[model samples]
Target: MRRPPMISLFTGAMGLDLGFERVGFELRLTLDINKFVCETIRANRPDIPIICNDIRRVSTDDILRKAGLGVGGPVVITGGPPCQAYSTAGKRRSVNDTRPSRGGDLVFEFLRVIREAKPQFFVFENVTGLLSAAIRHISFYERMRKKEHEIPPDARLGTAFEKILEEFISTGYRVKWSVLNAADYGVPQARKRLFIVGSRDGVDIPFPPPPTHGRPDSLDVIMGRKKPWLTLKDAIWDLRNRRDLEYLPFPSWGKYLKYVPPGGSWVDIPRELQREAMGGAFYSQGGRRGFYRRLSWDKPSPTLVTSPTMKATCLCHPDQDRPLSVEEYARIQCFPDDWKFVGTTQEKYKMIGEAVPPPLAFAVAKCIMKAVKEDPGNPYSDPHLKFNF
Candidate 1:
């Protein structure tokens, strides 16, 4: 069983890389554009080479040099490109915005690195929004401004997944993709992400490891087949007495959060107060469940966002009126107790929030390792053998 080395790009906080490292994958090099995140990596994992440069400017040769490996070496590459463009919360701009070359477009750079590195296996992770977001020539507002008559069919282009699959297949890899929830892999948050695993050697591309924990009424849990999901209390109960844990000052929204009960949100606020707290969004349609929401000790947390104190998406502590502390954020992301973050409170929160949960990444890595080691032959050789998950 050969353990492959890994090159991690967009390595925010090194959370994903940490998971791989736990499962015996060697961390050879880490790349990230954020200097603060690079410092954080250096502050924690000093032995791994850190390349704090933009991925667009990085070449395959540069990465190979840093990793001390030759081309076509046995290696696994992992990264989650910026996902804001494809995020459902915002306007889905596939490729038209032209702001820093557009959102979701950075996956191209990820692919470029993969092709250049020519790794044996690779893992690509991102928010679920990547599945349906289509490449666009312009924003909807811009299209309205143009007053374009008879919009052509090509105006809306291939979906992000379609484009990604095309590229992966063209690169001579067998690809398998699935949407995985972090809580299912023992993370204390219900963070859902899309994972694409590809193998260059015709190996059966593996899916996520099976769920070890599930919601109370989930079929597996109901049948006594899996453990119940871990909760906020499970992840942060010990920190309750640890006053030294660093935290950002509660946002103004904390006032309204006081009215929110465990497992509650802005709706828990008095109607009159809701108007004052939520302002114009109070009248907006749809459930604004995230606003001033408090964590429920019994349930897995909502997806951890970049800012726990933001008015629109608060992660108020289960018992306290404040947002989750930076230490709590790291714990929920499955980062070890001694793993330190570098920067101001807000910067630290951003780094932790953007990270892939270490537990989930470990599960994915185990699947990849099994596939590469036990099933290196093409899936077509045994059509009955498929990714059951």
Candidate 2:
């Protein structure tokens, strides 16, 4: 009759832990390597236990002992170690990339706690790029055409993910994983991430509810009702008063923001600056869209990155020229207004953009609570669970 003991959040960043918190689950403990992030957590939710250290160094004993929970008591684990190493964006560099592949090693640390704490369910999130053909190399298509099955398992998402799932299954948990786009769930952004869910029972986990907003016609589908997806206008319309201060409002936003028009970019810049800004990239083939790109008020936003201050991954305001502000970034990512982020402004942007959208997390948590609240023997089920695009 008692509820699951608690959710032990690892790689807990910004509002991601808070997402689980919104669903009526008590945050017994939260962990992340960034001191500023822990500061943020402590600032906003002081009652929750937050361990601000590398997950690699923290043991399950530390979590259990710190939270005062008994061994084997019900505990749900959630978090995503630094996923850059496994990211599809960077060259399929292995350990040499150094931007946190070792962070991926911390996944093992998460599994270690699973063996000890035995939570009912947990979710592992990562970039969809990791699942791409890039895992073979930049020349992946070439290499495949040329033939090479010898790719290392850790180098790719499909293979590496299977291993991650297998480890959980071996530990007596049923697992399911799917790539989900945040916009589909109404986050006002086009963020796509991989969600891996596992249950202690062998019940195959279910996919997230289908998207609320229909897919774009250009992408696929006929008149899929549901008003046009949210646009940049819809996202940051209220932040216009700061126009003079708008040019690249921060260290990075200034340069890129100057060139990107409300619905324009490098193409809109003076021809000389265009050549200067692009360098040889101008001559390169393909739709160099990201460079000096403008936002469309009629469409959802592109994936929110850790640094909106950076122009290269521009999510420029539709009418305004500056990069999305920290608060604007949070709104697009679906964080509630009251959800305060700890740390400096830049850190605030990073944590919020890097988080799982609160609504998406809410959906996932509701699914998790089903297993926690229902009969584990029935696998996982919920009657009041809400589903949206």
Top candidate (lDDT): 1
Best candidate (score: TM-score): 1
| Candidate 2 residue pairs in clash (backbone atoms < 3 Å) | 40-342, 184-389, 185-389, 211-389, 212-389, 231-297, 248-253, 248-254, 265-292
TM-score of model 2 vs. true structure: 0.82
The count of backbone overlaps in candidate 1 is 0
Q: Candidate 1 has what TM-score?
A: 0.89
Q: Which 10 residues in a row give candidate 2 its minimum summed lDDT? A: 244-253
Error of 2 at 286 (Å): 4.9
lDDT (10s digit) by residue, model 2, range 118-178 = 7767777767754552222334554455434565554443555555667767887777778
Q: Local distance difference test, per candidate?
A: 0.81, 0.65
Model 1 lowest lDDT segment of ten: 378-387
Write model 1 residue lDDT over 1-389, tens digit each, in one string. 34568889899998898788887788889988888899999999889898998888888899889998888764689998877777767577764444552445688888888887888889999888777666664565665566446545445434556877788778888788899999998999999999988888777755757988888888899899898899888999988877787887675557777788899988889987889999888888774777788889988888988888777888888888788999999998989989989999899998898899888988898787666556535221223444444
lDDT of 1 at 50: 89
